[model samples]
Target: MHAVLPVAKPIRELHDLRPSDLGPGILASTEPVVLRGLVAAWPMVAAACASADAADAYLRRFYRDATVNAMLGPPEIDGRFFYNENLDGFNFAPVRVRLDKVLDELGRYRGVEHQPAIYVGSTTIDTCLPGFHDENRIDLGGRDALGSIWIGNRTRIAAHYDLPDNLACVVAGRRRFTLFPPQQVSNLYIGPLDLTPAGQAISLVDFLQPDLERFPRFALAMEHALAVDLAPGDALFIPSMWWHHIQALEDFNVLVNYWWRQSPDYMDTPMNALMHALMSVRDLPPEQRKAWQALFRHYVFEADEDTFAHIPPAARRALAPMDGDSVRSIRAQLLKRMNR
Candidate 1:
C-alpha cells in the first residue's frame, strides 16, 4: 500500500527521511536519492487508492477555484511535450484555466479510448489552488519556499534542469523520472534557452525513440542515466541543475514538489552569469580562452578561503567581508558597468 509492488534499481534508497536530513549540507551527495514511502502516511495518498473520483474530491477540498496557467497538447504529439521538429517552436500551447475546471475535465475522460494531454505544470499552491499547502507539504527548512503542483494525464515533460533543489512527492498515480547527472550537461543536446517550453532548456533528442544518427552523443548520456518509478506516496529528491525527464504514467496523475535553495540570499542566480559568459567568452580563440579559464578558476571556481589574506581588513572595503549591504553595493556597481 505504501508504494507500487516493486520497481527497477540503480537508484540509491533512503528510508524514514526527516526534514533535518535535508537541511544544511544536503547537496554534498551529487546523486539522486529516493526517500522510500516518505509520504505514504499522508491522507491524500489514501484517497488516491480508493478511486479516481475520490482522489479528485480530496484535492478539490483545498482548492479556492482560482484560474491557473495550464498546458494543452493534441494527442497527435503522442504525449511527448516538447519543441517542434524544426526546433523553431514548441509543440504544445499554454492556456489559463480554473483548477476546478481541470478536475472536471479529468472526470470527463475517465474511460475514453484516447484523451488529450492536459497539464497544469508548476502552479504555485498559494496563488492558484489556495490553502492546499496547509495539509500537504514537506518539512524542509523552506518556510518561504513555494509548493508547486503538477497535474496531467499520461503526459511527458521533456528533459530539463531546474535551478533549485527539488523534493517531489507523488500524490496520485505513477511517475517515472529518468535523471542525468549535472556533469552530463554537454551530452544532453540542449535546445535554445529563449524558446523553452517552461523557461527551462530541454533536450532535443527523443529518449523513447532516439535518433542516434543525429544525436550521437546522447548514447553516452544514457549510459549515466538513473531511472526510478514512483507510486502513490513515494518521493524523490532532485538536486539543483540535475537534468531529469519526467513521465506521468497513468491516465490521471498528480504531484506536489518543493523547490528551495541552500545558498545565501545575497548570492545571485548563476543563470545570469551563464548568459553573460556566453556573450563575453564562449567563442574566443583557443589561447585567450585558456587564459580566461585561469581567471575564472581564481575568482569563480576556487573556494573563498583566505582570498584576501595578504591584506588588512581595514584596507579592504568591498573585498574584506560581505554582508547584505555590501552585496547590494556590488550589484549596483555591476549594473552601472552593464549600462555603460
Candidate 2:
C-alpha cells in the first residue's frame, strides 16, 4: 500500500532527546519531528523488543480486569476500519471487553495471515493500567497532558486532524505515519463532520488504494505528504491541526500518546464555531455572508491589538483576552441566545 504512492520526504529526526528536552520550543514547532529512541530505555519497550508475548505479559501485570471499548472487524475489512457501502454505518462493530481478553485475542491471532481486526484506542493510561506510568512516563514539563494507549494489529487509520498537539510513543511493534500540513485539509477530501468512525472527522480518500479519478485533489495532498516509520521506543511529535494517517505495520502494535493543547482549557473547541457558522452564516445572502466574513477576519482570524484598540478596556468585555470567568459568561450568553 505504501509503495503505490510517490516517495514522500522523511520527517526530520532528532536522537538521544530526554523527556526534559521536550520544552516549549519543541512543542511550539509546526512541523512533525521524529525522536528516535526517546523511550528506548522504557521497560515496556524492552519487553516489546524481546517479542510480542513478552510485551503482552508486561502489560498484563497492570490489567485489573477492566473492560475497554474496542473496535472489531472481520478479516475481509483488511484491517481498515471504515464506513459501510451506504456510508450510513460503520464496517466495524464497537464492543466492550476486558483488557486481558483483548490481549488474549491478539495472542490467538498473532501470526495468522488473515485475522479479525481488534483495536483498543484512546483508553486512559491511569484508568486501565493504574501503575503503568510509575514505571514508564514522560515529563511534559508541567503541562497536564492526557495519556492514552492504542493497541491494535495490522490496522490502518484514515487521515484525521487533532485539536491538541500530540506526542505519540511507539512502545511495541512497528508503525508508520503519513502526515500533511493543516493547509492540505481541502485536498484530503474530508468526510462528514457530524458522523465519524472516531470523534473527529477523517479523510474519505483511502491511502491504501486512493482512487485518483474519484478524488483528483488528493494528488495535490500527496505532493505535500511527509512519511516516517517508527520502531519500538521511537516517538513522533505531531503539531495540532496536522492531518495524519497511521498504519500499525507490525502484526501486534501498542502506542502510548500524550495529548495537550497550548490554549486555555476554558476556551471552547473551534469545531463548535464552525458548526454554528454553517447554520447561522453559510446560507446568508452572498453580500451578507461576505460582510460576516470580513467581521470574522477582523475579530477572529486576523485579530490583534489594533482590532480592539478603539474600545476602552472596561467596555471590551468579549474583546478582552479570554479567562475562565469571561468564557463562562460568554458561554452563558450564547446559551441564552441559542435557547431563545
Which candidate number has the best TM-score? 2
Model 1 residue runs over 4 Å out of place are 1-9, 16-29, 141-143, 317-321
* Pairs that clash in candidate 1: none
lDDT of 2 by residue, 1-340 (tens): 2235566789999999976678776777888999999999899999999999999999999988788999999999999989998888899999999999899999999999999999999999899999999999788989889999999999989999999999999999999999999999999999889999989899998888888888888888888999999999999999999999999988899999999999999989999999999999999999999999999999999999998899999999999999999999999999999999
RMSD of 2: 1.5
Candidate 2: stretches off by over 4 Å: 1-5
What CA root-mean-square deviation does each model show from the true structure?
Answer: 4.6, 1.5
TM-score of each: 0.91, 0.98
**In terms of TM-score, how similar is model 2 to the real structure?**
0.98
lDDT for each of the candidates?
A: 0.81, 0.92
lDDT of 1 by residue, 14-86 (tens): 7776534465444334668887787877778889978778989988888875898888888788788888778
Single out the weakest 10-residue window by summed lDDT for candidate 1: 1-10
